[model samples]
Target: MKLPKELVNGSIIFIGITAYFLLMVILGYGNSFYLRLVNIFFVFYGVNRTIQMNVKEGQTDFVSNAVSTMVTSLIGVFLSIIGLVIYSYMQGGDDYVQSLSETFLFGGNPSIFIYSVSLLFEGIASSVIVTMLLMLYWNNRLTAD
Candidate 1:
């Protein structure tokens, strides 16, 4: 087995992000069961790439890649949190509470006017988390070799 350091990292991040995305979709437990299919497909692609990638012997740039991936991902997370807070504040806690009670978190409550806004916030948060993790994995993996 030609254990090249760079290739291993690539595969981990590619697969990891796909897993994370699929998990969020699964947690939905609402109406999306095909999430796993997409994730698995991505995992396959990552695996294929890993197998094809050349893990040539050289100075493994793990440290730099790790730092870049971690730092930028942290920033993404921080910004997402801030955005969520601001969005929630705009909707007003009282209104949000009322909507939550009325719609039950599905974001579709004809009774509540704020469900759409809340759903948007949730989607944004989810996007941020997904992006952050994927970014970290990609950066690290790409630089490892």
Candidate 2:
């Protein structure tokens, strides 16, 4: 039974982000520079895998690659957000929420308004940046005359 291409790519993104987050949690690296580095690495890894999957499926056009990367990145970001929420709730949601607000926002309280807006913008920007960077890499590597 062959999985759909989108499903495969989405799984890659979700798994990559989840793995990174889990590692961070296990290592107690939350809100650290190492966590940021790992996040960047996992995001690019997902984009790379998505591009590779596109090539494997013979959908290697620039648009296809870019779209796959963007879709996969978005899915990963969505899953990561969900995972974070779940983790926070599991680890006493109130304190987790306060920590996030203090860490990211102005250190007051967990304002759902600010958190949601920030995540939305950050996810969109991250998808665009990752897609562009991966497309550039693939174009230069795969389409050179």
Index of the highest-TM-score prediction = 2
> What are the clashing pairs of model 1?
none
In candidate 2, which residue ranges exceed 4 Å CA deviation?
A: none
TM, every model: 0.32, 0.81
**CA lDDT of every candidate:** 0.43, 0.73
lDDT of 1 by residue, 43-89 (tens): 33433333233223232354443343343333333343344345446
lDDT by residue (41-129, candidate 2, tens digit) is 77788778878877877876898778778888887777777776777778777676677665453466754445655676787798899
Clashes of each: 0, 0
Highest-scoring model, lDDT: 2
